[model samples]
Target: MLAAMNRHRADGKAGEPVLTHRFLCPASAVSNLRDRLRPQEPWRLGLIVDVELSDLPHVLDAVAHDTRLELETVELRLPGKDRPAHAVDAARAPLGSTDASTYLELAPASPAVPDTLAACADRGFGAKIRCGGTTAAAFPTAAQLAGFLLAAVGLAVPFKATAGLHHAVRYQDPVTGFKHHGFLNLLVAVCHAVEGADPKEVEAALLIDDGPTLAARARGVPDHTATRARQLFVAYGSCSTSEPVDDLAGLGLLESRLA
Candidate 1:
């Protein structure tokens, strides 16, 4: 994975390779940290640990003050009602100098989600929405996703997405038959949302399957819109970083940074 990232030269420094993005490691994924550290190439920009809400206390106890790890974010899966608040409260006491960013994952339709996002924004945290999984149930419907985007935008909260977004355009996975949200589509939709586009308009953008057309729209996003959208949409995690980069290149929306 590191080799692939380096070959892409996404760090914008020829022959001076870096990850160009933060590598998210699950709390238990110690080997990833070791491998990244071994390179000693500044390959990682930041570290985010995925922690379960129930285990946050223990997680914090273990790493809250560990100077070795420059922890930037913690994404917590809300176990139940009001759990987002619980996670935020649990994290606040030990926030320390890291100024750790936090995100809560919740069902888009959950009644408590809007309030949770609002509270998270007020507390300087954000939200995370699961975009896909091995099963269809893991994916949010266009309406559901639009709702999440609207709520986040309305509350001035930033959010990140995870899983099953391996392609640039929305399409059905040949193996799973699950419709996956396109990473480009999501980015463009967020750009629209940051510009105050309605949920219906954002949903239409998310449902676009034409890769080039969607890429064109995304490329046309203004510099200011990109900045704000980056703040609100933040970054997403993908199992294979190369795939999304390849898709972007295919759409003519990206250029190789290599000299």
Candidate 2:
């Protein structure tokens, strides 16, 4: 079963986010991140992939070296079928504070993805669901993807996503010719459909299918520090970039941002 959501796209540039074929990495690393990211001045509350600062002894280690850093989360690439168990081993590696403070990865592709999610739920693990909003696989419709999100919840997949989403508009990228994030719409449906909703009920939410409608389902749901569902939707608002900065600003999820 398709378990999570993710985002990965690549622009061939000297210092661009590393993504292509299928992967995401910091474009380049430097001690002066503030100057480079050119962050929106005020800064935002989110994890910026400091590959240099990451733990887990993987590719990220090349940048951080052996020095331990205080990080809230980091993405890990699971090797293979044994990755679930492998992750456990990494977490237990004891690189001191330098190791993974908290690890995340594309919720595995094996049965392990869903299984790991369920297990983590019982243990309250933080796992991000990696969805493909940029693929050509044609697995299912956007609505079906929403079903998978709710199903993950039913099975107890803790942290999840509708990644790759970047718009409130429903259209394909004219360039790469792939679908981009319509996250507000997707999660809106998932949250509504998941609240005491079933597969068939989820089906209705999917059918209703509008950003405001979906967001409305979440009305009065409450929020907090470690809550996954709320965080997923909140993140969705920022990452969507399907349209040109100005055009998308007025048309898509840009309207959904909170002050």
Every candidate's lDDT = 0.72, 0.42
TM-scores of all models? 0.81, 0.54
Best by lDDT: 1
Candidate 1 yields a Cα-based lDDT of: 0.72
lDDT tens readout by residue for model 1, 51-94? 54454456555554444455577776654454667756665544
| RMSD after CA superposition, every candidate | 4.0, 9.2
Count backbone clashes in candidate 1.
0
Q: After best superposition, candidate 2 residue 121: deviation in angstroms?
A: 3.1
User: On residues 54-136, what C-alpha lDDT tens digit does candidate 2 reach at each position?
Assistant: 33245334435413222334444333456565554443343344433333444433446555555445543455545454466
Off by over 4 Å in 2: 1-70, 91-103, 107-110, 122-124, 138-144, 155-157, 160-163, 174-177, 203-234, 237-259
